[model samples]
Target: MNTNTACELKWGMLCAALIFLLLGACSDKDAIDTRPSYDPSKPVTISRFAPDSGGVNTQMIIYGSNFGSDTSQIKVYINGHLARLIGVNGTALYVLVPSKAGTGEVKVVIGNPAKEVVAAGPFKYIFLPSVSTLAGFTDKDGRTAIVDGPIEKAQFEEPYWLCFDEKKNIYVLEEFRGMRFIDADKTQVSTRFRTGNGLDRPRTLSFNTTYDTLYITNDQGSWTGLSTAVATKADNFTRWTSLIYSLQTNGGAAQPQTGDYFYNSYSNGAIFKWDRVAKVSKELFRIGDVSWEFNIQFAPSGDFAYIVVVNQHYILKANFNRETRQLETPVHFVGGRRSAGYQDGVGIDARFDQPHQGAFDENDNFYVCDIFNHCIRKITPEGVVSTFAGRPRTYGYADGALRDAQFDRPMGIIYDKESGTFYVADQKNRRIRIISTE
Candidate 1:
């Protein structure tokens, strides 16, 4: 009885000890962390972010610590909106703020455990006024809202093209009065100069900020009664008749001295660049076979130039080589289809009748005056075209919503990058019309 009892007791004790050991091992393994734990003491830190205030899609750099080498583990948020992560290192991260992100705190999260670090100061999401549509001249009545001209006198009678300087000063070209200048605040007006020397009609004006020069394109004949004569006399009458005048911010000699200038001949549809210093003129390109080219404009980026073919009722973009000052073959960017109706669509699907001039806004959106349609159309960078202002073929002197506002014939337009405003030459209305955000 004693031997049997002793053996059973020993085996029971051994089995019990084995069970206890097994449970202990399991508890230890459960307590051990397979993944590295974030240290509370060495918490993730975000020191700062560069360009703290920026608009949507702005690239931003964040400086921090413990952000891990793998960018895939890093997630950034600006004002609670997920930002597009571009790159990251252990100490810094590159990200693009989400479009339309509001002003709020910037947060950076790292690791599978998801440790988050917030910036010291809130990141400001700058909001620019979205100008998808036009609101007519911010005045009581459209007809009497000439900021520069006399209340009774139509100082802009036959205003053709207009532009704004960096300081927001305006320069307008008039068929009868030539060039007029208006101050930034619109309180002062000055008649700077007039076109002469057989250039009876000034059609367009271009400002080259790089060279600080003003280029004028003039037609040799009048549009009043010499349409047939202009067609026949074309090249001979308008050849080398354009002017290039040097511009001064202050009141200097703003005269056209006939130096080497670049001009467009509407009669023959030829574009020539003249070097007044060299006394030589070289023909760049011609669209005489297609239609008469009316206006030529260099992109604000200086990467391309757009030419408006009035008779063809379309616009063409020519790739310009800045270093060589040469233009490549032109490509149709907008309004190739010849429908005189007011419709907005994508690229060639949109129709423009007699697109007289074109201008580029801050975001590179191209705006054109659809002369016959009597409206301004905007073409996006992605080739989407839409009517931005004025009613289709509707003429009146009212001021309000762009669709409700009437323009007799808008021939020219220029955008103000600083204020996000557009000054339009309401040709038949005989006044300068303004398009601005509400």
Candidate 2:
């Protein structure tokens, strides 16, 4: 037991201690990783969604995070519902929280993976109440209204169409987002209607006042993500072409987008009309492959209709009395080139590069939002077109007026007929304009 044996014993003891220490370190690290980290310095900072602002989708100027970095598919949750969390950063995420509910609170739950909610809390205050429709499409006069939707005087992301039932409940129809409702006071209304479970592209809502029914059509083009980087696609539109849904309160028929035009991309690319009373549908008319028809309105006459197509495609009109139904043969409601070196030779219609969406101005005229072109066009029923708003440039023009300014993709148009006020969904600009016509 002299020097050699004693030394060996001591060395062996040291090795055992080191092994124990390593094991303890590893155990501690595992526990720490699994522990809850629901704290963030600043959860979400929002300044854009303030009241009286234009419509908002995913393009929110938000600041917050438990988000480490690389936000590809940040599925934010409000309370627990999937509010779209679009672009992301290490400490910030420009997410799309749904239109504010009447009284419910908004909480952010980030879900990119199966990981636990890194952070969840109420967001900036939202007071947007719901609008209900006594009849699906309320067109008393030039003052067209949706009991649960816009009143020809709403703005972007405002419910374009709203419907209601005998119960006095109102339901709203969103472009790519789904349906919501309101009570008598216009508080948020909740229904089973969904937003993006089966949309291939941007969608629209058409109601039949005659039958107390709803018609929803999805384009499938936007969801392809083949468009530009700014085009907003729906999560539900994995491969959806169109959807035909019906809102029959109590116990009514469930309608899916079917038939020749239910979800078909054929016959001039138009959305079909569903007869809620008859439970039958037919091809209403084709709006083409453009994303502009996301917001549609039937004329106060209830006999005519005008729709917009994306990117210089066209803003078309339909004559229900006529036999031949095409894209209503767009008369260049507004047209221009949005991209570099874009050219349309010989024809005025050729110049329209990226026309986003539009709605009707009171006199039954059209307000066509020409995105990237830096202007909106005023079109007549017979196809006479004029610049309605904005000017030539890469940005917005004049403060109150829609002057030349930067616009990514202005998607929705909300109009108020009473004041003759117009709100453009200047998407890229992330702003809404309040324009009045003379």
Which candidate leads in TM-score?
Answer: 1
Candidate 1 per-residue lDDT over residues 91-201, each given as its tens digit: 667777776677899998877668887898888877653323221233354343233443233355577777665566677777755677776766566666655544455
Candidate 2 on 188-271: residue-level lDDT in tens? 334334445443233444333432344444443433321101111242111223323321100011121121112223224445
Deviation of model 1 at 329, angstroms: 1.2
TM-score of each model, in listed order: 0.57, 0.41
Cα lDDT computed for each candidate against the true fold = 0.62, 0.40
The regions of model 1 sitting more than 4 angstroms off are 1-155, 195-197, 210-212, 222-262, 288-291, 337-339
Which pairs of residues collide in candidate 1? 259-276, 260-275, 260-276
| Poorest 10 consecutive residues by lDDT, candidate 1 | 246-255
Q: Looking at candidate 1, what is the lDDT of residue 263?
A: 54
Query: Model 2, residue 242: what's the lDDT?
Result: 30
Worst 10 residues of 2 by lDDT: 247-256
Candidate 1, position 299, lDDT: 64
